[model samples]
Every structure is written in structure tokens, then in C-alpha cells.
Target: MQTSPKPKLLIFDVNGTLLNMDGIKTAINQAYQHPGAFTQWFSWLLQYSLVDTVTKTYHPFSEIAEAALQMTAASLKVNVDAVFMQDILKSMQQLPPHPDILTGLDLLKKAGYKMVTLTNSASAAQKKQLEFAQLNAYFEETFSVDAVELYKPHPKTYQYVLDELNFDPQETMLIAAHGWDVAGAARAGLQTAFIARDGQALYPLAKKPEFVCADLHELAVQLAAL
Candidate 1:
């Protein structure tokens, strides 16, 4: 059997993958006083992003997020104002990285891999997230779909990164907590690693990625073996 080569460019998915979402999750749940508010809001955010992408229309991720928040509140018959919703979302900009993230990135960096981020957030939000998490310096660059005005799991979103870095699909690997994101990269001909974060799973029907690890630290250890 032919051996698969090691990846050169390591693209990371932010949000639940690298940064823990508990901070904002707590805020949303508390604001609504609803047990499942965070889950519902997040699902709506993702669903509508795809909706916009499929329709070839675009909205900033924050706008979609707030819309989701409002819709969730409406569904529950709870009152919410735009100002409060925006304040709740401001927590997203300051989310902290997971404990394992720094350790994992250090191992990857020492192993001579180039790292970057690909996120659904707007460019400004992405920058603030990285800076607030103190992870900006670890990455060579970061990408936001805001440029293409298309969210992830879209083939073009992955293509944009490949084009920007001039790396062939096979030479790069996308690491994400979302099964759909991993599937998208696989479809785009890139290598992939599925980070099995809490409450996340791979799509059963999609092609399996080359690696599936329990956490970023575990993924780093596995990749270092290569």
C-alpha cells in the first residue's frame, strides 16, 4: 500500500474546536433562562449560514448569530432586545482557548508544521478571538469565510485557503470538530483530522478522515508520530 505523506499546512477550525464555547454558552442559557437555548441558537446559526450560502446571499456571521438568538427567544415566547443580544454575543470575541490547545499547537509547531485558522466568523471577530485567546502569535495566518461570503462545509471555502497559501489539496490537512467541516475538506481533496470534542460526532455517511483523536493534545501526539 502507498503511504500517505505528512501534511505541510495544518488548518484549524476555531470555535468549539480550539476555543471553548462554554463562556458564551453559559451567557446565552442564562439570558434565556432556558435549558436548551444555547444548543438551539447554535443550530440556527449554522442552519441559516448554510441557507444563505445555498441561496448565494451573504450576511455577517454576527448578524446571523443575533438573528438566531432573537428567533430562539421568540420561539420560547421570551422577550429579547437587540442591545442585550448584542451584548451577549460580545462574549464570543473574548472566548478563551481550550487548555489543550496551547500544548497541541506547540507540539505541532516544533514538528515544523505551518498552522492557520479557517472560521465562519467575520474577519474582525476572528482577529479579536485570536488576540483575546492569546493564540494569534501561534498561527502564521488566519482565514475567515467573510472574504468569500460563504460559510464552511462549502467547497469554495476550502478552495479559498488552498489558493491563498498556494498549497495543493493533498499537501494540506484541515482539523475541525465539526463532521460537516471535515467532510467538506475531504470532498475538496485535502487530508483531514476529526477532533472529537464533547457533543460532536462524525457524519456516518461521509468519508472517514485519516485521523480521529479525542482532543487537540491527542491529535498532536498522533501527528508527531508522522
Candidate 2:
């Protein structure tokens, strides 16, 4: 069997991958007074983000986030005014990195891997979240789909990063917590690592990630072995 070459560029997915979303859950729970409101809001946010992408109509991720929250609230028969929605959206900026993120990033950095981020969040918002979490230093660069005006699971989103880095697809690996994001990178010919956070699973129809680890620290350890 031919061995796969070591990856040169490691692109990470932010949000639930590196940054924990518990803050979001808590905020939604408090504001909506509805059980599972966070899950529903997140689902709607993702759905609409892709809807915009597919329709070629772009809206800032924050805008979509608010809209999704409003929709989620309405579905649960909760009426949230604009001020309440803004407060929920603002919580996104204060999210902290997952417990294993710093250690995992240090392991990769010490191993001399080039790291960057590719997120669906707008560049400004992503930067603020990373900076707030103190994770900005670990990454060499950050890219956002806002640059391409598309969301993940779109082939072009992955292609944009590859083009910027000028690395062969086989020599780059995308690490993400979302199955759809991992599948998108894999479909774009990049190698993939799936960080399966709690309650997250890979899309069964897509190709499997080369590595599936429970947390970033574990994923880092596995990558270091390569």
C-alpha cells in the first residue's frame, strides 16, 4: 500500500471545533425559556447560511445568526424582540476555546506545522472570537468564507484556501468538528481530520476522515505521529 504523504498546511475549523459553544447554549436557554432552543437555533443558522450560499445571496454570518435565532424563537412560540436577539448574537463574540484547544495547538506548533483557520463566520467576528479566546497567536492566518461569500460543504470554499496557500490537495489537511465541513474538504481533495465533539458525528454519505479523535488534544497527538 502506498503511504500518504505528510500534510504541510493544516487548516482548522473554528466555532464548535476550537471554540466551545456552551455559551451559546446557555444564552439561548436563558433568553428563549425553551428546551433545545440552542440546538434548533444552530440548525436553522446552518440551514440558512447554506441557503444563502446556494442562492448566491450573501449575508454576513452575524445577520444570519440573528435571523436564525428569531426564527427559532418564533417556532417555539416565544417572541424575542430585536434587543434580545442582539444580546444572543453578542454572546458569540465571547465564546471561549475548548479545553483541549490550547494544548493541541501547542503540540502542532511545536511540531512545526503551519496552521490557519477557515471559518464560515465573517472575518472580523472570527478574529474577535479568536482574540477573545487568546487563540489567535497559535494560528499563522485565518480565512473566512465571507471572502468567497459562500459557506462550507461548498467545494469552492475549500478551493479558495487551497488556492491561497498554493499547496497540493494531498499535502493539506482540514481539521473540523462538523461532518459537513470535513466532507467538503475531502471532496475538494484535501486530507481531513474529524474532531468529533460530543453529540457530533460524520455525515455517513461522505468519505471518512483519515483521523477521528474525540478532542483537539487527541487529534493533535495523532497528527504528531505522522
Estimate candidate 2's alpha-carbon lDDT, on a 0 to 1 scale: 0.89
**Least accurate 10 contiguous residues by lDDT in model 2:** 1-10
Candidate 1 lDDT over residue span 1-226, tens digit each: 1156899999999999999998888878888889899999999999999999999999999999989998999998888777889887798998889889999999999998999999999989999999999998889999999999999999999999999999999999999999999999999999999999888999988878999989899999888878
Query: Which residue runs does candidate 2 get wrong by more than 4 Å?
Result: 1-3
lDDT of 2 at 41: 91
Which candidate tops lDDT?
1
lDDT (CA) for every model shown?
Answer: 0.92, 0.89
Can you write out model 2's per-residue Cα lDDT over 67-179, one digit (the tens) per residue?
Answer: 89878877998877888788777778889899999999999999899999999899999988998999988888899999889999798998898899888889999999999
Instruction: Report clash pairs, candidate 1.
Output: none
What TM-score would each prediction reach against the true structure? 0.97, 0.96
